[model samples]
Target: MSPVRRQHVILRVVAKLLIPYILLFALYVQFHGDYGPGGGFQAGVIFGAAFVLYGLIFGLERAKAAAPPRIIEILVSLGVLLFAGVGVASMFKGGNFLDYGVLEHDPLAGQHLGILVIELGVGITVTAAMITLYFYFAGRGRA
Candidate 1:
């Protein structure tokens, strides 16, 4: 099927309207995760879903233009590095790997910061991976 044929006025309008709300919720989940059940994984999925929805309604090329492949690849790597760097930083602080207690002068603050950083890294990686997967699958049959 031609990519242009996928565009429908209603679908595009709905998607455009919903995408912001979805992203807003994703941010909420990411930030509120510390006190609730939601976290990086859920937030990432939600964020990715918005883009995937855009692709489904708009087109893969447009989606790709919105999140270029090179930028996505960098994000994937950067996320992993951020996660690992946190662990390594803890080690340097004379704490065990993944030790959040050493991240700040106050143990509680340190733990909170560590968790935030870790979750952010995870969210980034998951978001990039999901978008990458969508691109690959969507591109499969295209000429």
Candidate 2:
């Protein structure tokens, strides 16, 4: 194969290998939300950024092949639904919207669960939305 195509293949292999670790770190951030700044928003961006970087380095077509728009759309909606669902649950449970303390018999546990869920939702939304935008911009750039 040509040097340019060979380089693409090499870069793709490296990116695929690193993608898993990046995703793992994002999960770690999601889980660590109970203690630190490494919560949903940061985690989501961090997660999406890896893929975006992959696209930039390899090709937008490769990125889109990796993460299609349909998938991103579904993920974005899921995140919003998850957030609203938790809020509605809190409302029904006699607390303000998103007050997770109502989720369990132990209000503190409920709070922790609620925070984790909502933080996850936030992370998903941020990641999906950012990815979708990245795709659009990258696609435009390609044109």
Candidate 3:
């Protein structure tokens, strides 16, 4: 254990308790985004914040172990691909790019599905990007 972890036992315990709830809240914000005020961006930030908090309380190495940089990079690309894939799929369905109306037999269902998928992509991208940024900045002075 590092000096910070050893010194801040209470903080570590508190963080352990809060991190799960934070992640859960992020999920709620993500799924409920379309009908409510929150959305992918908000959920992504919240999710990233949980990992950041874990990094702060525990240590950067441990956090990195939990969420590897390579995986994060892959997620960033995967999210963009997923977003664009949806648009392309819509086009293949005989609609304009990102035209969710043609995604399904029922236009309303297509719209719902499109929004859900795109928002999920946004959330993944944002979450991964945020963690990558944190890793970059936090690890900068170390090596």
Candidate 4:
């Protein structure tokens, strides 16, 4: 009815349309890192940016509801575990820590798999951390 309400509707429509594309691009960066210059770090930042944009367009409460703090913490821990688990697995495979050559029957495949897993871990951690930071800062001084 009001101008503010109309603007809100438009904003919501635009965000809903854009979020999927943003997340898809992030995935591309994550999976295509081996061939290109982008990697987990870049992908994570892009993924996190999508959430941050959602928060900016919607509200902090909605963002928190979408990604709870507990889930974020768990993702952070799991990312670390995933990264470290690769190293541990290599050790058990009779290779030095982070030695990807032992991850599979073929050394090249092993290295590729190892890099993918580690990059995934990195992406998870960075994405969670960035979202968590935004939640905390946005919620600061609130009742």
Candidate 5:
């Protein structure tokens, strides 16, 4: 192993322990955002932080391996599509743009569903964008 890796054994171990919990908390925040004090953007940042922590400790190359740039790019586009698609779907369903009330047989259920999906799209986009930025900036000025 390289000297740097050998020197950061403690950091690597701690990161391993913390990363899972961070991801779990992200999920909790994501699903619970509608009812409580959390949401897609927050969860996305937290999710991105886990990978950022991994990169800081393990090296950028390893982090990229864990989450490739291509996949992250795809997710960014996909997330936007998902979000916009929801709005378009609502239009098709005979409602105004993003009219969640038209999303289901019942307005309440449709509201729940629309919010959930929209939040998910936001989370995915933010997470991917964060990772992409990290990869771009980190890869710069490197040999």
Candidate 6:
């Protein structure tokens, strides 16, 4: 991956500037997904992408410092848990699993929020899993 990426101070600076906002936007996308085309899954990918690029340039250790393995693993589980937990919560609130209506005082709005949160969860988990997998095998079979 590092070999594939062209290294330049400008690109690194650009990436550094963009990464935080990208992650922040991912959060916005995750939370506001009900009314938009974005969702947690997409947000996760976008979020993970920043670090992936970072790793490609600076090496895995720096990337890990940005997002530690333990934290990433937890985030991976947390996102899934959040999605599933919402589903279960909805079930108890007289709706089917993942039904958003039970999420708030207003069922319609609740649905929107619920979907956003769940999608964000999916994104986080997926992104973390992908990065983790990449790193896990990144060092293997490389000359």
* Top-scoring candidate (TM-score): 3
Instruction: Report the Cα lDDT for residue 71, model 5.
Output: 94
Supply every candidate's count of residue pairs whose N, Cα or C atoms clash at under 3 angstroms. Answer: 0, 0, 0, 0, 0, 6
User: What ranges in model 1 sit over 4 Å off?
Assistant: 1-7
Candidate 2 overall Cα lDDT vs. reference? 0.87
Ordered by TM-score, highest first, the candidates read 3, 5, 1, 4, 2, 6
lDDT of 6 by residue, 1-143 (tens): 35545457787788888878987887787666767777767777777777787787777778878788888889889988988998998999889988899889998889777876777678879889878876777645452
Give each model a TM-score.
Answer: 0.93, 0.85, 0.97, 0.92, 0.96, 0.80
lDDT of 5 by residue, 1-143 (tens): 36768698789899999999999999999999999998999999999999999988988889999998899999999988999999999999999999999999999999999999999999999999999999999999695
lDDT of 3 at 72: 98
lDDT of 1 by residue, 1-143 (tens): 36565557787788889999999999999989999888888998999998999888878888889999899989988888999999999999989999999989998999999999999999999999999999888888865
Residues 17-132, model 4: lDDT tens digits: 99999999999999999999888899999999999998878877788889888999899889889999999999999999999999999999999999999999999999999998
- For model 3, the local distance difference test gives 0.95
Output the better candidate (2/3) by lDDT.
3
Candidate 2 positional error at 1, Å: 11
* Model 5 bad stretches (over 4 Å): none
Ranking by lDDT: 3, 5, 4, 1, 2, 6
Please list the C-alpha lDDT of all candidates, in the order they appear: 0.90, 0.87, 0.95, 0.92, 0.94, 0.79
| The candidate that achieves the highest lDDT relative to the unseen native structure | 3
TM-score of 5: 0.96
lDDT of 4 at 85: 97
